[model samples]
Target chain A: MSIGQETVLEANEARVVYNEDSDNPVEAVRSISLDLRKGEVLALVGPSGCGKTTLFNAIAGLIPLQGGRVSVGGIEVEKASGHVGYMLQKDLLLPWRSVIDNVTLGLEVRGKPKGEAKKIAQELIERYGLGGFEHSKPSGLSGGMRQRVALMRTLAFEPEVILLDEPFSALDFQTRILLQSDVKRIIREEGKSVILITHDIGEAISMANRIVVLTNRPATVKTVHEVPWGDEVTDPVAVRDRPEYQEMFSTIWQELELTNGQQGKTMKGAA
Target chain B: MAMATDIGEAKKQTAAPPAPKRRPRNSTGRLRIMAYQVAVLIAIVAVWQIGLWTGTLKPYVYGTPWGVMQAFAEQIANGTLLRHFWVTGQEVIIGFVIGCSLGSLCGLMLWLSPLWAKILHPYMIALNGVPKIALAPLIIVWFGLGMESKIAIAAIITFIVAFLQAYKGTQEVDQDLIRLMKSLGATQWQTFRKIVMPGSVPWIVSALRLNVGFALIGAVVGEYISAEEGLGYMVYYAGQLYDLDSVWVGIFSLMFMALILEAVVARIEKMLDMEK
Candidate 1:
């Protein structure tokens, strides 16, 4: 690896293990190395049990990595820091807080006076279609709208890197595409780096500049698809429907085909 | 608890929530609720008065509300009512303030230290189960029948309830929100202050509102054990003297005091609801 590009997040031989108190503790992630350049989206794509979330956890400092190091902006992050923002599966909006107040939470914790943060948050809310809803509580919004508020919250802090742990997985199919497109536009306009954790191959293909494919539990990087649509991609759903998208999907599918088979058996039995 | 919540909800049909508006139940649901409560009181008294009339009920066993009212008038005329009422109010106010603060602080401390939480959790739970009256003597022995003793008893009663709830409230903070804050690089204290504290506000307020009753009970009961002059002491004296009316007056005064304190604390909770 040249290691020359402006890397925002680098996980060198990052390993993670679930240290269950039980005797047979399972390894969640095994020896993974990856680099996400600034202003780029690096999507982690794999099967259901492929340790994608585990890797994201390791990177975000949500879990302690058993091996190697993860850094943000060249500084080691032993614990998850505000330098990165993680939009969860749900919007995770503070239900009591108004949409604008939820967005300004990070700033408030950082001791930014509320007045300034609120103005910036208001602008972001209005800019990204949450204008009238600023004064509303999280309960008032739909799933898609809630996610938008959450995205705005993550964006408000202006972190160097944002970690998205299946941020759109909760919404139905149609809402997912719209919010995903809005998110893509916001990311580009702001020029922040993102590490998107998703199982959907199509999602990986359309939005990411590079897709990191991983094996099931004890996962390591299987391949990196230097995706082709970085310049051509505009609409998230449109790009997701493109022919190349299907091609990218099959390629990663073939790589994780074996792990997917095992996962299918366990999931079937569990269900 | 379910009945209490339902009663609270049923009374507040007009509470607004266009902007996270806090819905208070009009402090025990207004004087109408009190009227309903009074009706129940009257029905019980009517049964007792009939029992007295029929000679089936001993006067010593149950006194009529009218009889209690008569005794109340006598105390009012003699001016002993003012003395005991003032003393009881002072003890209750002082005990309430001390108890509530200690309980709230204990709650915070327990929530912050999991190690101590593990060790003390069982003890706290055990104490809550034990009759606070059972320990009243022990408390008096330790702190004396002075105001400190009364306050201490009240604090113990209030603290257990407050700590259990506040600890649970602190623990009940949304995990996803904490994760989001962590991913955003917020420090532990930042997460606690911004996310944890704010999340616990509603729970804390409700707990505080509840502790008001417990604190009052603590002060009153402690006074009953051995106080020179207090509402509880006055009631004890009246019962001993066979003045059932005076005893009844003291009890009613206590209910009135409890209602007033609840209203004030509830108002304070509402003012702080802007956190939402």
Candidate 2:
């Protein structure tokens, strides 16, 4: 709403269709447009099968758009662009690799010298409380710690925009809240912009500066709500304690509830 | 058995609850299983020994276990067993290295080129379907009646096995991980090096494990067909002379060689951290 902040990522009428050549082609995302501002967390929330992941993949340039464009730093995104770092729902850490090796995978793939990559990975590991677990495998780590390692890996490359696709969903509620705060703090401290895709309204309200709600399949932008949090409440767990957090959560919940009801009625009518 | 069960029940009752009974039970199970295996082997040997001593079975045909041991000792004392063992061992090792390296490399190449993979898929399947031991005569003809023929036969067998496994390994890599690597701006080579290669280590190690026996089979078969040396030649020579004890010695030596090679491959798998 304000022209004060800089836009780091912009998606212009992005469209995605699955099995486009087949007779039963499914349109996953239908012309959704949004912007990720500099140093701000933008959460995209929607119901199941809403193509939030499809949009996230498009933004990350993992999939080509049927229509419109997604760009970071004014450069059009393409497959394997390295302009943005993506953390998927699953940690996707290489089980065979040690924590440090897994974290520095991107750097090594990008052809950074091994010593330099390890140094960068080491610093991130120490900073993110994964200090002593450097040589440990992903199988040896707890779910939350694995996610932390995943986050550190995403940050190891220091891309302009980070795309998180339900990164904390697999964790227990307590760990999820704690990790939300940790990730928010780390992202903010590093001055990186993030586009977080989640189905959890509370997570969206607590972690993001702006929340983009989407409609069910053939997903389109429903509405965007700027989180009404004070500057002092940076921690997601602390933000949850604020009265505004609940109010915003209820508001988004109602929006989702209405969509669910409509879908139920439509299904019943079909039956 | 009833008395033993009662004593076990009494001990269980006396033992504190939640005292980690699992450890002792597991150890006992392992010990019992090992004892049963040893007993089975000893019983078979004992039966054979009794039959021979009672003249129920001819020692000339089946050979006495003691006679086999004596023959083994005689060969060892004269260093003939060691000489033949070294020759066969060298063939197996050299063939395994050549076959595994070339096979995995070819597999990777095919994976990198889907067109080549498509073209070669049927041929590979056909080659794999053929019993590689049947190629012994052809191999001997091509490479001559020396260790070269044995090595060639070994290499061919191991190559087919390793290639198929490595190809399957490459295909089985997680597509999600590939996409993740691609999103990181990794080039194709980078993805293959950092993700595909490391991911396929388990499959490659398994292939290597299987190839160990295959290479030995190839070498032994080659020697059976034409070689003047090797444990296979010893078996052939012993069989021709009706020296069943020496034949058993040769056969046992080949089995021992296979087990040792498999153990080495397993150790390498452990070093690669591919073992589950």
Candidate 3:
């Protein structure tokens, strides 16, 4: 963890409340803040339904924050729209579009010329090992292939920061392991900062340079652990082989369980 | 992570290519089914013909199949049936095109504003509830007794069905897809063009198929009230003269028109499908 590295993204006192106008407003996130160093992989891990996705939406600027602010490379999230590339849990590919067309969607939306967008998308497809599948529809691809295509689509725009919201949650166990390594290698080679949200402790241990543990709804940062491997080991498989990996995994696992216990105590008090 | 020692130990293996589907060539079974259908038709016609010859059926009320065939031949020779067929065909084509385009455009446009859609929802439902056929006389009075009135009726009938189906389709588009579009820096217009429009296509095509029947019904009903031409007028004139054979000919001609229109719509659907 180098303190001198420049910060690429920052969220300060961010909060979100669903149904804000209703009598019973639901607080999703409460006063959460974090920062990502340039070229760092930051993982946010928490228990299921802990409003992690709500926090991701806030960072991506898809939903407005009720309080506080999120900014990218010193620009406000709203004005820094194109600087962040978001990869959702589902592939969300346009079914009618071909592989090349889906990969170029962000570029096209940004008003890039058709020929130039296609050219950029084509280079990415070839570089990412999807060269022959340029014209294939999303329905024809397997789950792993679809997710890879989605990552490629995000990378095509070359955004300074990429937000991955449970990108591998929908995959089978074996596929998830392989894709974790593949995605980590790609992100490392590209030198782009990333904020990955996941519930899997092992995944956060394997891929992130630093892990942020969040509490249950009205989510706030509970703890932050700096991975032992840091930037020295870029491979996820190699990260798993480290002796400290299991220790880190259990520590985060206990922290998540503590969150659940706190939530249960609150529920009992209300009852 | 080290505790999960066997995470990537699975050998790299390629999945086998999926088996090609063998289309069922049940020619023999299909032939058997066709034979039975033909037998049923033959039995029905034979019984009708026999009933006429034996005086069990009244000839004046139930015209013989041969007599109806002769009436078709007579009209073809005189060219009267062809003229009437052409008139009805033109009315159906023009009215269907006008109604279908306007209805679909208006329906899709409603997606632009939630407030506008909410305000107009009940009015659309009420207008759709009224039996469009009941408006034929008034439509005739407005558009005149000629083909214009018949066209107006056909257009009006087809409009509601297309409008409702397309509006529902617009509403049914996946909200997540729109969210994705916005995240990618797409404008409101881009979201509609890329996501909403393509998503609603299946609904619009189905509406076109359903409206084919409505368009024909509108044309016939309009002609039934007042017209000098069209198959409906031919049927009415034959009934006045007690020409049951000619009446059957007119009814059968309209059936053929329906089949042809349906085939045309199916062809258009295939074309749209290819674009995807």
lDDT of each model, Cα atoms only? 0.77, 0.85, 0.85
Interface DockQ of each model: 0.61, 0.49, 0.47
Candidate ranking (DockQ, best to worst): 1, 2, 3
For model 3, the TM-score of its B chain against the native B chain is 0.86
What would the per-residue lDDT of candidate 1 be over residues A77-170, giving only the tens digit for each residue? Answer: 7887677877879777887789999889878877788899999899999898778989998888899999888888888878888888888888
Which CAPRI category fits model 3?
acceptable
Candidate 1 chain B: worst-modelled 10 consecutive residues by lDDT: B9-18
Candidate 3 C-alpha lDDT tens digits along B1-276: 121112112211111212333544798987988899999989988999999989999889988899999999999999999999999999998999998888888878888877887787667666666777888888999999999999998898777767766766777677777777777778888888888888888778878988888899999988888899999999998999999999999999999999999999988877876676
lDDT of 2 by residue, A1-271 (tens): 2222789999999999999999999999998998887888888998898899888788878889999998899889877578889898899998778999999998887789999999999999998899999999899999999999999999998888999999999999899999999998888788888899898898888888889989887999998999876346788878888888888889999999987888898889999
TM-score of chain A of each: 0.91, 0.95, 0.95
**Clashing residue pairs in candidate 1 (N, C-alpha, C atoms within 3 angstroms):** A81-B184, A81-B185, A82-B184, A82-B185, B68-B245
Tell me which of candidates 1 and 3 scores higher on DockQ: 1
Q: Work out the TM-score per prediction.
A: 0.84, 0.87, 0.89
Overall local distance difference test of candidate 3: 0.85
Give one digit per residue, the lDDT tens place, for model 1 in B169-245.
66667777777777777777777777777776666676777777877788788888888888888888888988776
Local accuracy of candidate 2 as per-residue lDDT tens digits, B1-276: 232233223321111111212444587899998999999989999999999889999999899899999999999999999999999999999999999999987876666776777777667656766777888898889999889989999998888777776766677677788889888988888888877787777778778877888898899888888878999999999999999999999999999998899889867866776422
